[model samples]
Every structure is written in C-alpha cells, then in structure tokens.
Target: MHAERLYPILLLLGSNIFMTFAWYGHLKYKSSPLMIAIAVSWGIALFEYCLQVPANRLGSAVYSAPQLKGMQEVITLLVFAGFSAWYLGEPLKWNHWAGFGLIVVAAWLIFLD
Candidate 1:
C-alpha cells in the first residue's frame, strides 16, 4: 500500500507497544509501590497517546473512525498476546487463541462494505 496507509499502521504499532508496556509492564515490578507504578504507567501512556492520536488523525484520511478503531483493537490484542506470553510469562490457552481468532474475524467484517 501507499505511505498514506502504511504510516498510520506503523504509528499504531509503535503506540500499541508502548501501551502494552504501560498497561502491563508493571506486573513484573510488584514489589514497587502502587503509587510509583501508577506514575510510571501514566508517563508511558502519555507517549502512547502521542503516537495514537496522530495515527488516528492521519489514518482518518484513508479510513473511517470505526475502521480505525477496529484496527486499533486488533493491534492491541496482537501486541498484548505476544507481550503476555513473552514478557509476562503468561501462556495463552486454546480458548484465548480461539477468542482472538474471533476478534480478528470481527475486524475483517468491519472492513466489508
């Protein structure tokens, strides 16, 4: 695809990476104070929003709001799945994979005219 379409995808990917860390990275640091974790997560989330907002804005030129949101959800799940397994040491069960597959199908349906 053209840069117009590709750029937003890249931005969203980057944003989701940051978001996954922000949301779940602290699980490994349970010994840290809750206040400290919250503060750090908020800082990381600020960067996520920075990228996410621009991604949606640029993507809006080529995609509808619902389409953008659908894409974001898919990206989030994919990123979280990997992050959960690799970084969080959480193994996804068969049912989790099936649920994720269903969500992927739902995302595909959102693109249908």
Candidate 2:
C-alpha cells in the first residue's frame, strides 16, 4: 500500500495506544482519588485526540468515513485485547475471541467494494 494509506494506520495505532491507556489504565490505580484518575486520563486523552484528529483528516483523503470508523474499531479491539491481558491482568475468554472475529468479518465487509 502507498504511504498515504499506511500513514493513517500508523497514526491510528499510536492514538489507540494512548486511548486504551486513558480509558482503562486507571483500573490499576483504583485506589487513587477519582478526580486524580480523571485528570490523568484527560491528560492522556489529549494526546490521543491530537493523533486521532489528524489520522481521520488524512485518512479521509483516501478512505470513506465508514471505512475509517471500521478501521478504528478493529484497531481498538486489537489494542484493547493486548492491553487487558498484559496490563489489566484480564484474560480474554473464548467468547471474546469469537466476538472479535465477528467484528473482523464486519470490517472485511466494509472494505469490500
């Protein structure tokens, strides 16, 4: 694929890494004050948005909105699966894989002409 296509995927992947941490990394710090957790998450989310906005804008030049969203969903699932298992100590059950597979199928359909 061309750089135009690959660049957005790379940006989206980086953004999702930040997003997953912002959204769920706090589970490890549950003992912290709610305000503190929220503040840190917001700080991290700022970085996520910084990348996410540009990714969508650049990706839009080549991909439809639906395609971008489908890509984001798939990336999110893949990132979250790793994050949950490694950081959160949560093992994915069989059903989780099955559900993710179904979503992958949906993403494949979205990319089909």
Candidate 3:
C-alpha cells in the first residue's frame, strides 16, 4: 500500500516538473510569438497529462479521488517552488518559506484521519 501510494506521488512530481517547464519556460523564449509559445507549451503539457491521468487512476485504488487531487495540488506547489528557485534563479525568501510551511500544515490537516 505504501509503495502503491508512492507511485502516484512520484509520477505527480515528474508531471509537475514537466508542467512547470512547459508553462513557464516560455518566459525565456520571449522572442517567440505568444501563439508559438502557447503551441509549444501545449505540446509539452500533453505529456504531463499523460502521466498525470494514469497516476490518478492508479492512486485511486489506494486513495479517494479527492485525496489524490489534494496530494497533487500540494505537490504542484512544492515542485513549482523548487523549479522557480532553481531554474528561474529566483531567491526563496523567508516569507516564501513561511508560506510553504503553512501549505504543508494544510496538507497535513487534509490527510489526517
């Protein structure tokens, strides 16, 4: 059960990475027209959804749909925070950390039995 749960979480992490890049990497390609950027990002996001769908289906065997969705939302924020700090070269300020801490607490509350 634990391993099964971990599978979807890992997939969600990978999907989030691809998604973050697809959605925001366009900023680095500002010279491209908006339509071109949207097209490219949409192409990349297709793969994200590919992994995400199966992840949720597999995850549903162990967790309720709402639970899986909640988990994915939390992971999305976490992945975005790391990607922004590392890839985007944004400074992770104290307030950002504090906000993430609150999000973690919220996740914990949601997952609590």
lDDT of 3 at 81: 87
lDDT of each: 0.96, 0.97, 0.86
Minimum summed lDDT over a 10-residue window in model 2 is located at 104-113
lDDT of 1 by residue, 10-68 (tens): 99999999999999999999999999999999999999999999999999999999899
Model 1, TM vs. native? 0.97
Indicate whether candidate 1 or candidate 3 has the larger TM-score: 1
lDDT of 3 at 65: 78
**What is the TM-score of candidate 3?**
0.90
Q: Please give the range of 10 consecutive residues that has the lowest summed lDDT in model 3.
A: 103-112
Q: Candidate 3 — which residues are off by over 4 angstroms?
A: none
> Ranking by TM-score, best first?
2, 1, 3
Error of 3 at 18 (Å): 0.9
